[model samples]
Target chain A: SQQGEEDPQALSIQEGENATMNCSYKTSINNLQWYRQNSGRGLVHLILIRSNEREKHSGRLRVTLDTSKKSSSLLITASRAADTASYFCATGAQGSGNTPLVFGKGTRLSVIA
Target chain B: DAGVTQSPTHLIKTRGQQVTLRCSPKSGHDTVSWYQQALGQGPQFIFQYYEEEERQRGNFPDRFSGHQFPNYSSELNVNALLLGDSALYLCASSIRGIAKNIQYFGAGTRLSVL
Candidate 1:
């Protein structure tokens, strides 16, 4: 079963614009993380926000977590053509000691130059 | 330093056949986890290993099994292969302490069950 479901399935934006992707999960989580995957490539970790954190930032990425609503959002500011990729949200289920992360289908973003 | 590594970037198999995929974790990492990603879907956790022991599992059936070596490398084996098993299999490695769940993934093995 998928723990996270990304909203807007896909997004297209111009370079220099900001792209936002949302993810909603069903269970309590110890942390929520965002990752980026270029076509046919392995996923690269973007940023992680712990349950106690409301938001986090890394380079051009901003991640916000709303544990009460079981949702999170990832914003990529100054989107670039190089940022064209699929973004995924993964959750480490609360109390699930040492379990692998449960991921979402992801949002496919296309940045037009 | 080398990150996680997976072998045989691709594989083809038939129904009722068995296949094995391999992974070598990043240096100093001790845990290995496997995930299955179908086209247009997220990677689903198959199982995790630590200290050569199966520490946790997802909803996958018994046909999906794994082995972890003393060197912290691992293998994912699937028996009675079905078309539905055709997907990208990923291997992720992480440390055991404060970074327990922050995994580094290897380029997945693309499996095709014919």
Candidate 2:
């Protein structure tokens, strides 16, 4: 079964605007990572936030994690049309050394010019 | 360094037929993982291979099996394929013992079972 569930199955926004997507998980996670898939192709690793960490940033991407709530959010600033893709959130179980990731149904983001 | 790579970008097979999908891990990576993504759904973990051993597996049945070579490359084989087996197969590579365990993925092979 999928551990994480993403909210706002789909979202649309104008270029230059910010887009936010949230994900909730059922189990305790050692870490939470976000990935982006383009046109159903390969997924690109975006950012990762460890359980001990509350927030992280990579270029235009910012990620926040709340262990108490078992949820995470990805914020993309200054969105561009090129940013259009499906964003997914995956969780690594605590103490599961190098285990497979449990992914949530992705959020399809569309940036219109 | 080259990223993870998979062959036969697209494939078509009939029910009850067996199929094999191949994947080459990224350089310096010692682990390879496979995932099955149905349309409009997230990728489902199939299994993970490390040290040429099946270290972990998902809830898939025996029909889904895999082998990892000494070179760290891997293959996913499904026997007696059913129409429900159609999906995009993804291959991911990562280094073992890494704290983050971040995975690098390859463009998946789209399989269609008729």
Candidate 3:
């Protein structure tokens, strides 16, 4: 079963604007991570926030985790056409060690210049 | 100096045949994990290898299996391939300490099952 699901199936925004995507998971997680994948490319890790952390920031990306609600959100500031890609949220379930990851059906973001 | 690398870049296989994909993790990473991503879908975990042992697995069946070498390189072997198995197979590697799960991924091997 998919552990998490993204709210918006797709989003479109202009360059310089901001985009937000949300994800919700079912089980207890040790941490939540966000990744971006360009069309026909490998996924690039964005940022990870541990269960004990409520928020984290890396470059232009901000990730917030709400452990109590089993949800998380990713914010990309100053969007660029270069940022156009599929964004995925992943949760590492506490017990499933060595398991690759339970990824959500991502939110496709389109940044138009 | 190198990141995780997965090979062949692309492959074509026939249904009922078998195929093997390989990966070499980033330096200092001891665990290798594999994920399958269908077009327009998020990646699904297949399994993970640590210390040359299968440590955890996803909901996938036995037809999907893997192995990790002492050098931390890995291979994913799919037997009796099905068209449904056609997807991008991804490999990720991570260290084994407290930062056990921050995986760095390879570009992924695109597998086409005819």
Candidate 4:
């Protein structure tokens, strides 16, 4: 079963505009991670936020996690056409020593120039 | 360092036939995990191997089996393939001691069961 569900199944925005994607999960998690996949290929790890962390930033990406609400959000600043891809959120279960991640259906993002 | 790698980038098999997929983990990684992803869907966990043993598994059936070698390479074998089994099979590798267990992925093998 999938543990996380990404909102706005798809999103389209102009290049240079910021894009926001949200995700909600059902069970407690040790960490929440975001990954990007291009054209059905291998996934690239984007960012990871632990349960103890509320937010984190990397380059143009910003991630926020709300453990109490069981939700997380990813924001990409100054989006570029290169950022066009499917974004997924995955959760590592609490107390399950390095267990397989439970993934969401994902949100497809399109950046148009 | 070379990242995770999977072989037979694409495969076609008839129903009821058996198929095997291979994966080589990234340097220094000790754990390998497999996932199956259908069109327009997220990747579903198949199983994980560590120390050359099956450490964890998902809700897949017995037809889905795997083996890990001492060198941290792995193989995913499926028997009596069904049409619905057609999908992209992904291999991920990570170090067990890493706190976040960040997984490195490969391009994946696309299996087409006819």
Candidate 5:
């Protein structure tokens, strides 16, 4: 079973616009990471932010985690057609190993170019 | 230079039959895990294997069994398949056990049960 849920199940935006997706989990975590999936194929690792950290940035991606709220958000700056894909947030629970990341339902982003 | 790879990108099987899905871990990886994702749903954990043993499993029944070979390649077998079993079978590999590990995934095998 999946331990997290993502909102805006689906989103559509135009090129050059920014996109934001939110994910909420049910348990404590050691680290929260984001992934991207093209179609129903394999998933691509994005960024991982540990629980002790509140925010992280890499290139055009920004991820924020609020442990008090048990949630996290991923922001994509300057969306492009290549950014269209399903984004998922996964967490390695506090006591759980990072091996199998508990994933969320995912948010589908469609960037219109 | 090869990433994780799964054989038979697509498969079709009938209900009540059995099927096998294979996976080859990325070079230098020693752990393999399996997941099942139904249409429009998140992937569900199946099991994890390391050093030719079943290390951990999720809620799946005994009908779902797996094996990790000495070579670090793996195979997932399911018996008495149901339509609900038709899903994307994903295989992920890691350098060590699942705990505190980052798993790399394969393209997955799309199984369709008729």
Candidate 6:
């Protein structure tokens, strides 16, 4: 079963515009990580935000986690056509002894050139 | 350094047949995990292996099992498969003991159970 729910199941935006996706989970997480997957391919790790950390950034991606609200948002600044792909949020449980991460259904982003 | 690798990019099997899928973890990675993704759905965790041992398992039944070798390579086996079992089987590798270790995935094996 998936632990998280990603909002805006699908989004389409023009190039250079920002894209924002949100995720909400029900459990107390040790960390939350985002991943990207091109069609017919495996996932790629994007960024991870620890429970104690509220926000993190890498390249044009900015992720903000609000543990109090049990939600997180991923923002892609100046999105490009290459940014088109599915984004997923996975939650790692706290002290679960190497338990596997639970992922959300994912949000599909389409960037128009 | 080579990333995680999986064999048999695609497979076709009939119901009740058994199949084995293999995976080799990325260099220096010691943990291997398996996931099943049905079409139009998120991947679901199957199990995780560390130190060549099955450390944790997800909601899957006994039909799904796996083995981790000393080299941190892994294989996922399914017996008496059902048509519903058809999906993308992914292998992910990560170093153990790192807090929230980032997992690297191999292009998954697409299994089609008829």
User: Could you give the C-alpha RMSD of every candidate to the true structure, in order shown?
Assistant: 1.1, 0.7, 1.4, 0.8, 1.4, 1.0
DockQ ranking from best to worst? 2, 4, 6, 1, 3, 5
**Each model's C-alpha lDDT?**
0.91, 0.96, 0.90, 0.95, 0.91, 0.93
Clashing pairs in 6: none
Candidate 4 Cα RMSD (Å): 0.8
Clashes of 3: 0
DockQ, per model, reads 0.65, 0.79, 0.60, 0.73, 0.59, 0.66
lDDT of 1 by residue, A1-113 (tens): 89869998999999999999999999888888898888956888888888999988899999999999999999999999999999999998776446579999999999999
Please give me the total number of clashing residue pairs in predicted model 4. 0
For candidate 5, write residues A43-62 as lDDT tens digits: 88899888899999999999
Report model 5's TM-score to 2 decimal places.
0.96
Which candidate should be chosen as best, given DockQ against the real structure? Answer: 2
Report the C-alpha displacement of residue B112, candidate 6, in angstroms. 0.6
Each prediction's TM-score versus the true structure = 0.97, 0.99, 0.96, 0.98, 0.96, 0.98
Please say which candidate is ahead in TM-score: 1 or 3. Answer: 1
Candidate 2, DockQ to 2 decimals? 0.79
Expressed as tens digits, the lDDT of each residue in A12-52 for candidate 3 is 99999999999999998878889899996789988888889
Query: How accurate locally is residue B94 in candidate 5, as Cα lDDT from 0 to 100?
Result: 85
Write one digit per residue (lDDT tens) for candidate 4, span A1-113. Answer: 78879998999999999999999999989999999999999999999999999999999999999999999999999999999999999999887547898899999999999
DockQ of 6: 0.66
lDDT, candidate 6, at B107: 89
Clashing pairs in 5: A97-B99, A97-B100, A98-B100, A99-B98
lDDT of candidate 5 over B1-114, digit per residue (tens): 899999889999999999999999999999899999887877778999988999889899999999999999999999999998999999999877344467789999999999
TM-score of chain A of each: 0.96, 0.97, 0.94, 0.97, 0.96, 0.97
Residue-level lDDT of model 1, residues B23-114, one tens digit each, is 99999989899999999999999999999999989999999999999999999999999999999999999887554278899999999999
